[model samples]
Target chain A: MMNVWTLFIPELYCLLMAVVFFGLAMSARPNPRRDYFAALFMAGVGVVVALACVRLEGTLFFEAYRVDLFSQVFKVMLAMGFFLVVCLCTELNGIEERHHPEFYLFLTTCTLAMMMLVSSVELLTIYVALELSSYSLYILVPLRRGHGVDVEAGIKYLMVGACASAVMLFGLSYVFGVTHTTYLVEIIHVLPGVIGTPAAIVGLLLVLCGFFFKLAVFPFHFWAPDVYQGAANQVTAYIATASKVAAVAIIMRVVALSGGSSKYLVDMLVTLSIASMTLGNLVAIVQKDMKRLLAYSSISHAGYVLIGILSMSATGYASAIFYALAYLVMNLCCFLVVVKVSHDGSDLKIAQLAGLHRRAPLLAMALMLAVFGLAGIPPTIGFTGKFLVFAAAMEKGYVALVIIAMINATISLYYYILVVKAAYLMEPDEELPRLPVSIPTKVLTVALVTAMVVFGVAPSYLLEVARAAARMLM
Target chain B: MIVPYSHILMFAGILFAMGIFCAVARRNLIMMLIGVEIMLNAAGLAFVAAALRWQQLEGQVFVLFIFAIAAAEVSVGLALIVYAYRRTGSLDPETYNILRW
Candidate 1:
């Protein structure tokens, strides 16, 4: 009983934090001030506290929610990401001052929902958790001040998200009708027997559609670029990193339903992977806006991650996990620079990065490392992640897929280097003064850059953990 | 004995398809929300019918949760509509493209 309670500590803490933040926001009188720093402090503490629970394992609520090695590992990654993002959000200039605490409230709620999402082993719980997170994000987008684009992105995100979830629910109904059970463990036991049937295949794919939307895979990825560009830089960072981490975890969970040898699922995954990589990389080449460029780049990376997932093996799952963590760090490093550079809280263009090295040397160096890592250049974690994922695909005899992935990588390198060149070689205007950087941001930049290279060169510890976590799903 | 399970499923499927069509075809934001509501209700109807056929309480329970979720989604959905309307002065999605590449 105590252990069960312990397993729930992180979620309870998050809920408490959200409620407390809301209360603080509501009760403030003449000052009308919300403690943004406190919000960041709580998020940082919450993640650190969550990290301590990595070893505890239990199931509660009639085994509907699982607190296993796999879930805990993902939870730690998510919490850490939440912490870093809150830190990065220290100055959310785009948001109105009074709404500061409310913003943190939504952020915590979304994070809490994601925490629940990974732990849920029941279908109904999964849907509810997904909605909770989705709704929170829907509200967060439009919170940006008086911008038609933000509202537009909010509406598009809401409508598309609602449609996708409805489609997913329609599929879930079929899954329930076919399997007659909503618990994942039971479904896993029964699915292999029925999965070869048309109903099972369709139902499973439909269920996957919800997660695919979150992951921004091909057909479901349309909202990502627009929303990324429309939302605040901090919100975009949260969406790109932490939300993506949750999507990867859930995708692994759902795909595990097939029980090892579903060729049809493999075919579907292959098609999505190839299309996402090709389309994402191709569109990214012409993107002028920094956020939109990163959005397409993220979509392409989603494709690379799929190569591991579709392999349907432990090595594949582990590689995907490694890649997700690496992607999170590299992407956040880039966003940190964007957040700092866009001092007025407006969208940034690619050309705006000209002479970043001269404006701020540390930032320029950090951005270089991130772009190099994203482009999958060697001695960075991105290369290691891609190599492992591609190797996993080859192990599964996906020769054609591997070749296409390589081509996408080459195409992606072009745009990534273009940004680097603008940052390093081109010169800024004479009048604009040097960009100011506080001590903490400088420290974070150093840490993020160092981690990218260190983890790339010596990935044994992370690889072993990832392999262990992947084995749990098997 | 009164109604076959296939008929219930067929009815639900048609309802769902209609809901999807309204959602995709309609230009008005409110109409799209209505379509989503219809789709969700169709899903609930299917779950209830399946529950009756299977004689399991879980399906009925799931429908109840769906209703709760659909309600929450609608409230949020409407609030967003109002928010967007206030900002853009129109409900048409065509006019709201600022971040296009």
Candidate 2:
């Protein structure tokens, strides 16, 4: 009994954090400093709690939720993501000061929901958990100050998200009708057997749609650029990093349900992956707003991650997991620069990044490395992630797919270099004052940069952990 | 049990399509929300029919959960719609394209 309760500690801790923020939100006046410190402290503690529970394994809620290495590892990643995003909230200029507490509150709830989402093994539980996280984000997007665009983005996100979930639910009904079971454990046994049937195949594909929407896969990716540009930088960062990580975990789980048997499923996924890569990269080249560019880049990363998942092997799953973690770290580094550079909370234009090398040398360096990492340059975490994924696909004889992905990677380098050029070589028409870099941010930048390089250079430890986690899925 | 599972599924599928059509074709935000609600309820109808077909309680239970979630979704959706309305003074989605590329 005690052990079962221990498996839930991380989520419970996040709930407590949400409650604390909720209380703070109810206070008469909002003190941004107090809220920021409280959120940072609580989020830090949440990370510790998640890490402490990473080794505990059990089932809870009548086995609707499973706690295993896979779920636990994702929990730790989600916690870390929440903490890092909170660190960027030190200057929450994008949102109104009074809305600060609510911002932290929604972020906590969203993190908590994602933790539940990763652990849930029952279909109904997954739907509930996914919606919980989506709702939190839907609210958070519009909380930005002085922008009708935020509300517009929020509504679009809500509409599209609602439609996707509806399609997912419709699909779930078919899955239930066909399998007569909601438990993933049971579904896994039954689904692969009938996977050749139109009902089973269509149901499974439709189920993947909800997660694909979350991941910003090609057909479901229309909202990314606008939402990333309209929402506050911090909210966009949370969406880009933490939300994406959760989406990858759930999609992998759902895709694994096919047991790698359906040729049609593989073909469909392959098509989507290739399309996402091409469309995302080609469109990203013309983006002027930094966040919008990252949004399109995120679409392509989704494609890369899918290359790992569609391989449908333990190595594939492990590589996908590794890619997700690598993405989180490097993407955070980019957003950190975005947040700091756009201190006034306006959308950052690529041209505005001109002379960043002089304005804040450390940030410029961080942005360059992070952007290079994103472009899959050698000796960076992104490159290592792409290598692992492509290798996994190659092992599965996806030769053409891997070659196309490599071409996409090369095309991606063009835009990423443009960003670095803006930061390093392009001169500002008017010399701007140097950005004020705080001590803690400097430490964070150094830590993130080191992690990117060190992990990229030697990924053996993380790969082993990812492999262990992947084993649990099979 | 008298109604074939195929018939029920066909009915639910039509309803679902109708909902989707409303969501896509209607220019009004409130209508779009209604369309989503209709789609959800259509799914719920299928779940209930599925429950009857399988003679399992899980499907019916899932419908209950769906109802609760749909209610929650509507509350949030309406709040967002209201907020957008307050800001732009129009319920048309076309009017809310300030964030276009």
Candidate 3:
């Protein structure tokens, strides 16, 4: 008999951490420094706990929750991501001092919710978990100090998120009415017969909109640029990387419901992919703020990830997973630079990167690696990830898609290289002070850059792991 | 039966559309939140109707969860709106546009 306790170790750890943080934050005159360190320590423990749970396999909560290799892999990755974001953000200067511990409380809760989301196999459970994560993020967005932008970002994210969920719920009701079950496996069994029906197709597409919103796909991507620019740098980094990984995981799971039965679904995905890439890349070229630029970049990346998803094959799914994993490191590398260079917890512009090579050589190196990787330059993980995604689409005989993706890649290079040029070629102010980078950031930069190059050079191992995870859905 | 299932569904659909309209057209944050509440209630109504149509309890159980989640969403949402109002002294979203490209 598998005890429910065994299945919930990671969640329990996260909940405990959240409660401790909440208690500390509620105390009279909480010290931010102490709470910050405590939060970091808890995240480190979370990483260990999540890693330890990776091999446990069972079901709990009357089979609504599953513990399997697939969920475990994502849980471990999300925990590590949480740890990385906490480590990278040593200070909470952009946030009000009193709310610092509260921030960690929300962060832990969000991470916990995502872990639950990955394990949830029932529709209602998934919806509840997603809302938990969304509500936490909605609160976190507006907590930025001294900026009206934060409030705007919060309201926009909330309203849009609520609308998307409402649409998704209505769709779920249709699905439930048709299938008479909310369990994914049962729905998958029933979906094929009904999938050809117009109602079923509409419900499936509506269901995808919630995740599309989360991934910042076109038509649902309006929140990304605004929210990215408005939120604090650390918060932006979390959204850009970790939350994106969660979105990718959930998307893969949801799209798997089709089991490659419907041509209309493929067509829909293809159209969305093309639009996302073309619009995301074209709009990104004119962005002045670094965060906004990356926001558009992420949108385009979401398009590229869709290529693998649209392929509807195991290889395609694996490539998408690999791409998301690689994106986590590469995008964080970029935000790490942004966080360091901003210095005063304000928004950073493209021009601010001028003479970064002079101000901080290591930071400049990391930025160069990240941008080059993002541009799909060779001998970097971005190139490897994109190569696999494109190859997966090509294997499916999507020649036009491949060509369009290539064009978008080429178009993206101009803006990416522009950033690199600004950093390496432009001169610093005559009296500008040199940047001071802490030990943790230096270590993180080196680690991320090394991972970028190493993973690019030797992707077979990661590919194999990604294949196994993909196989679970198949 | 007191009402046909289609009639209940039509009523829910109209309520949902109106809720979406209010959410999109309104400038006030509190009004937008109310719109969301109305939309959620529409979902609950549909769930209840489905339960009666199927003579199954699962749909009713689902509605219970929906109520719980909608309450949670509203509580946090209202708190956030209050926080924003305190800081900005206004509820109009247009005035909060400090991060435009």
Best by TM-score: 2
What would the per-residue lDDT of candidate 3 be over residues A1-474, giving only the tens digit for each residue?
447697799999999999998899888895877987898888999999998888888888888888888788889888988898888667677898888888888888999999998888888888899989988898888888866788888888888998888877877776776677788888899998899887678778878888898899998999999999988988999989888888888888889998899999999999999999999999999999999999999999999999999898999999998999889989999999999999688989998899999899999999999999998998999999999999999999999999999999999999999899989998866746789999878888999999999999999998988888888878
Per-candidate TM equals 0.98, 0.99, 0.97
Question: Residue-wise lDDT of candidate 2 within A343-410, one digit each (tens)?
Answer: 99999999999999999999999999999999999799999999999999999999999999999999
TM-score of 3: 0.97
Query: Candidate 2: which stretches are off by over 4 Å?
Result: none
Question: What is candidate 1's CA lDDT for residue A326?
Answer: 97
Top candidate on DockQ is 2
Colliding residue pairs in candidate 2: none
Query: Local distance difference test, per candidate?
Result: 0.90, 0.95, 0.88
For all predictions, the C-alpha RMSD in Å is: 1.4, 0.6, 1.5
Cα lDDT tens digits, model 1, A190-296, are: 89899988878888998899999999999999899989988888899999999999999999988988986788999999999999999999999999999999999
